[model samples]
Target: MSDTKDSDSDSGTGRCAGCMESTSEKFRGFLNFLWNPEEKTVLGRGGKSWGRILIFYLFYYAFLAALFAVSITIVLGTLDPNEPRFQTRLQAPGLSIQPKLDASIKRTSDVIFTAGQADTYTQYTNTLTEFLKPYKENQATLNNCTNGKVKINQQYSMEKPPPSCRFDLADLGPCRNEPYGYDVGRPCIFVKVNRIIKWYPVGFTDLSKAVGNADSNAPPLKDVLMARNRAYDPNRMYVSCYDVTSGNQTYLNTAAGVSANTMYYPEDNGIPFKYFPYYGAFLQKDYMTPLVAVQFNKVTRNVDVRVRCKAYALNIQDNERMRIGYFTFTLRVNE
Candidate 1:
């Protein structure tokens, strides 16, 4: 009985050892098949099959990369670096003003400041100072085009660049002063016509008659032309600013009374014809946009006065919402 039990135990131990060895051998075979299989295969794929797949994918990706590069090159080749491909919005250039309020202040074209406080008005003066810096520097080097005649450059070239007219900073007169009138109640707002490539303004031959027939929103031509020591020119693009606090009625709010006391730098209240037909920044590197500084001499203190400035020309359109040739801003001078 003892011998029989011992033999049975020995037989059972031998069977268990054989089972473990079979499992180990199977695991080794699976690992070998994953790395390098028999019949010269790797991961169940023959060497030729693996090479074929790699070559196929390499050529496919290479073709896709080449196609993408060619598409980009073709698109870029057709575009001109100097000129914009589309200029739909530039048909009638808009108008912009400087000494604008800081972006942090959420105001819609409002210049609000205390006359006596430096912090309130310093930002305004600083803005004007920086904006006029380039004009001051490049004044001497620019071409002095004839005042009444338009400067036209039909053809542009690398050798002979387009002509750029000199916009002398001194011409800004009182507005060019260090304080810029912000210290006092008076404030000088610089108005500039938006630059449109190769677009020149065609001035009204007959100023009085043109104003009479112009859009209802047009600035009063009679009041604009009657500026003190006025320098009126029929061939130049004119700018006029008037208080519109009470509906469409245009007048300057003054201590004396409602009158046209607003003043423009250059005495003419107009931009000379010589500065028109801007040849873009690329062709005319040092080109300066002509400015008309509108000075509000006495704009009733502590009141939000609505003011609208318009640029008059035959080609320019009067669209307040679109800001084609006019811009409206609020001015408030605090004590």
Candidate 2:
């Protein structure tokens, strides 16, 4: 009888150890799924408490689902079915107003003694304004063309110059730097810019009227250097002009900066042009010159640009025949 009782006790002890091991492993897995366990999984004499806990979990999940559903419903209700509201959309703020255009146009007798003076501050404000009027309108039309549902891209008759150009140039060097534009393979450099400009307001209220026959001559910079004071020195520039991709011969931003001997090629990499998307106009013009920069920065879109071109007016006196001109007109968009 004693042996029988001892044997039965040993058998029950072995079974309890096995059951405990299995329970430990299963509970570990359950704990992994539940993250933190606050209540038990079963119910009865031992698990009536667990039953209450399970009910609590069910209520918690139901509450979370209801809150989520309510949030989604509210968001959907705010948007009109006819008016598409893209969750992911971006807009460029028309052309950023550079503050430089706010300056006065010197309005001299709008006549060119030599062809060099036609695009000067006293002359080209009227010329470029007329030339660029159509361009400004075209740009506006392109910007307004899209409404979240459709994506509109503006393809120019002229694409950004090749790997060496913002678009294709008739030639490899600065667009038409020669009297005859010839593009032989020359090493081309590229720089992209974005920034801010202060407008000083050119007085022509109607800048869009096409004025003179912009007979494509030498690039304005080339013309200025060769014509203004006739170069014996390495520092001066010839006026070189090219038609921008805006599909017009001129826009109001083109004007000549007066220099006694030579105009400076702008090298400003440290300053950022956050508000100016059209900042490349100067960069392209300056890149071909003897302008040297020790460092440069990059331009990104959608942020405000806060940079200034160190536009130095060359000191000139009439007795000195070496007056070179630099184009210094600013472009403004009225939103």
Candidates in order: C-alpha RMSD to true structure: 7.2, 21.3
Clash number for model 1? Answer: 0
The Cα RMSD of model 2 versus the native structure comes to: 21.3
Candidate 1, residue 45: the lDDT equals: 88
In order, candidate lDDTs are 0.78, 0.28
Candidate 2 regions exceeding 4 Å error are 1-46, 76-335
Q: Candidate 1 — which residues are off by over 4 angstroms? A: 1-51, 101-109, 208-216, 227-232, 248-252, 255-258
lDDT of 1 by residue, 212-327 (tens): 22333554565567545454576788887766675544324563322456778887878888887777778888889999998887777787887878888888877655668788
**Candidate 1: which pairs clash?**
none
lDDT, candidate 2, at 95? 15
Best by lDDT: 1
Tens-digit lDDT track of model 2 for 194-240: 11211111111222221112222213222333434443221221122
TM agreement with the true structure for every prediction = 0.79, 0.22
**Could you tell me how far off, in angstroms, the CA of residue 95 lies in candidate 1 after the best superposition?**
0.6
